[model samples]
Target chain A: MAMSVDLPALEQTAAPRAAAAARWSRYARPVLGLVLPVALALGWELVVALGYSNGRLVPPPSKVFETIVALAKSGELSRHILATLWRVGAGFALGVVAGTIMGAISGYWDFAKRLLDPTVQALRAIPSLAWVPLFVLWLGIFETSKVALIAVGVFFPIYLGVMGAILAVDRKIVEVGRVFRLSGPAMIRRILLPAVLPAYVVSLRVGLGLGWMFVVAAELIGASEGLGYLLLDGQQLGKPAQILAAIVIFAILGKLTDWLIEVAAAPLLRWQDAFGARGGQ
Target chain B: MLALKEVGKTYPNGVHALERFSAEISPGEIVAIIGGSGCGKSTLLRAIAGLDRASTGSVTLDNAPITSPHAEIGIIFQEPRLLPWLSVADNIGFGLADLPAEVRRERIAAALARVGLADKAVAWPRELSGGQAQRVAIARALVPQPEVLLLDEPFSALDAFTRRDLQDHLLDLWADTRPTLILVTHDVDEAVVLADRVLVMRPRPGRLFEEITINLARPRDRKSELFDTFKRRVLTALDRSLDRSVRDVTDKSSAGEAMWW
Candidate 1:
């Protein structure tokens, strides 16, 4: 539509208010969000030192830190972390791509949905770790099995999220597509994809977190060098500090990956933020 | 010419949305279809745009039957319906995807200029105000350079001031492009302000009740007596249609009662 008005002028006038809000969010919110976590860590250190649970099961925070520092000095920390990272990256990528393709196809076409949905739904009920034995038998006790397990873990949330998002798209917008005489492929590309994107991103984060959880399960079977391997090693060697360190690493890594996904999706989600702003107007 | 030859629509569940709805719209003529809720104003417009089909009879543009949505027929629904993902220019240029990039850009730019949103080419639809989004919708509809433009309560959701502003914008557009315009609305004032002739519709088996020609000059004053006269006339016709429908229902019941009496 031809609209000739000067939007920049209006935006310039509104820019200062938006700038102030952004300034507050950029600096303050993250610090505020971190407050509880930092407090909990300090409190946990005090409790363990004060003989809570006899300081054996949980280990003292200082002991865990020392183990982390020792591991870092020997470069074992980097090696294990890198190994886990690679597996998660490979598995998550494969899962999300495949899930999105299949989800979009089934969501848009009734024929595809009819053929694939029932089986996918039934399989989704089976836990990701349940496939560990089967995957190991087929792919062996190597990186392939570990990655495949994580991939299976990641796939379901994304598949379900994308399909649900597509189904939930406003019928009014689809009618707009029909009015424009958009071809079937064109409708899916322009209308369906964008319509489902915000929910798909949320599912991506969920799938990534699930993939991390399954890493331990995958590594429980003949894995040599990952965070999961560290956990098993600490258990076998009877080292509480090492096990605690692995748990800490998993927690931090999970949060970090979720943050990265959100950052990656910010551009796509900008329109939604603008939509909320328009509502206030 | 755009023509509906006794076009009718009956839903699969047996609801008669429209029946024998016929009209002849010459090139550049502005026609408004006004009816109360459930009178099938939107159904008629949808049938004309070929978004929906007639159960009986036919809708034609240039004598070719319209069985499905034709690109040459542009429509503006009640909501702006701009794809939230696209910028204003991209939304306007959406239907023009088959054109070369340069030609499409040129057309988009021209359309933006026409709707007074030339500077908003890169702005997202979410950034636009309700009126602005509606204007973008108008641009999107007009950019395709369609032979017939159909609007279904296009400004009903807007506030009075915004609605009036858009009404003026639409008139300017009609004056410029002169495409055969068919607008469906319930507002009597809106019908009188923009249409060359207004067609009133009756409920139940929706059909045309009467057609009133609006002979006001360009940029018709909403405050003028002539404008009020046309509004009153349309309102009277609307009242007549409602009364007639009610009477028909009572007559049917009374005929059964007469046999028992």
Candidate 2:
């Protein structure tokens, strides 16, 4: 009824300006998302120009960028990045595999859960950093200690994620699996794992974030190379640009790894429409 | 053929959901069990599907005791339980894992076509409406070509129009496949319209009260007097069962009033 009454008015008054405004609306969200970071960087540059804080003590964005370029030219940046990546990669892989397997065993079998769940619950209460000194004492100040520390940090969240996913699977769907007479391995592979992918991916992201935090702690205590070592070296040498450079690298790498995981999991999780991301995509 | 011999279920909390429930379904017959809520209609269906065990007696399919789920029996739940991660075709092909790849594809395609959803072969379950999702679930169960089909209030949640449409579709599918079907429903008209024999059950300790055969011809007319007669018979049986409980409640309340006096 409204359409019938308003049709002529809409046709006459909907101007080209409105059409252009509608066309530009699509880019508004992305531009708005980017505005704050650009503004912050500009403010930082202005502060540096006005001599706010000693330039030597707190390097501006340009000096940090220059340090990054120099580090890249000397192949130092890639070396540190590779070292840090190796630690996170190895630790994350070990943690996810071990956590998922143990989680599944406990989640599926009552006897195993009865034996292991209490211990896991108790261990989860201890801080991940508390294990670092003990790990260094046992394994020495080698790569094992750093990797093991990150692994321990990554383990708890993933373990909890897996258990929650498995336990909360819809009972009706499980009944369908039973109706089809799907065996244990087939049911796990086809149904349970796929059902838990979104939750598991969330845990993976959390583990990766925690992994970075643990790597810095391990390197701060004892390490020769990697971005964490660079952080300590910057502090001791009083090179603010180097310190800012390390911090920027950590931020960039964290975002990059998260993007990579999202890209990898997108196709596998295309069937999901519950996250409110479907309409935009 | 499937048979339930004095099958009974008692929960751990000692609620007797079913008692001495016995029935035999022939190779290609449609049987409907009509009862009120908590009449153990769902429990009886689950026992036949090997999803729940009857504590007292046994449910056997083709002379084999149903100790666990078997591939030869297909069950459609009240909710459409499609795995959301899978495409429509994959969900339909779920129970065909043991078949050859080409055969599985053929069967899935056929099932989709049967359900008039051939165009939605690749659609996700979440993309479908309630009725469409239910149809996909039907396809999934049908693709297995099981010998026995069990339905537990499969159309009760749908709108009236969708319910009628799916009911007709189900009848067509049954006519074509000739699988022995056992449908549990509370709708008396549905029981009369679809079943070869309608079994009316009473609640308390759930047991069969009466079995009424519908001798009406194929494509039975709902407007016909005979159809109404059968519907009335089932309804009367249900009302009579409910009336007993209502009278018992009233009697207990009046006895309390007498104590006050």
Best by DockQ: 2
Report the lDDT tens digits of candidate 1 across residue range B125-176.
Answer: 8778999999999999988888999999999999999999999989888777
- What TM-score does structure 1 among the candidates reach? 0.86
Alpha-carbon deviation at B120 in model 1, angstroms: 3.1
Runs with alpha carbons beyond 4 Å of true place in candidate 1:
A1-25, A40-57, A133-140, A274-281, B245-261
Q: Per-candidate DockQ versus the true complex?
A: 0.38, 0.45
Which digits, one per residue and each the tens of the lDDT, describe model 2 over residues B1-261?
799999999999999999998888899899999888888899888888889888989999989999778778898989999999999999989988889999999999999998988988998887787898999988888877889988999999999899989998899998887999899998888888898888877787888777777767879888987677777767866787666654311111111122345
Chain B fold agreement for model 2, TM-score: 0.92
lDDT agreement with native, every candidate: 0.86, 0.85
Residue B175 in model 1: lDDT:
76
Q: Candidate 1 on A1-281: residue-level lDDT in tens?
A: 22334568768799789879888877897699889978987888898777675777777678899999999999999999999999999999999998988887888778999999999999998876788889889998899989999888899999989888988999999988898888888888888888888999999999999889888888767778999999999999999899989989999999999999999998787667443344232
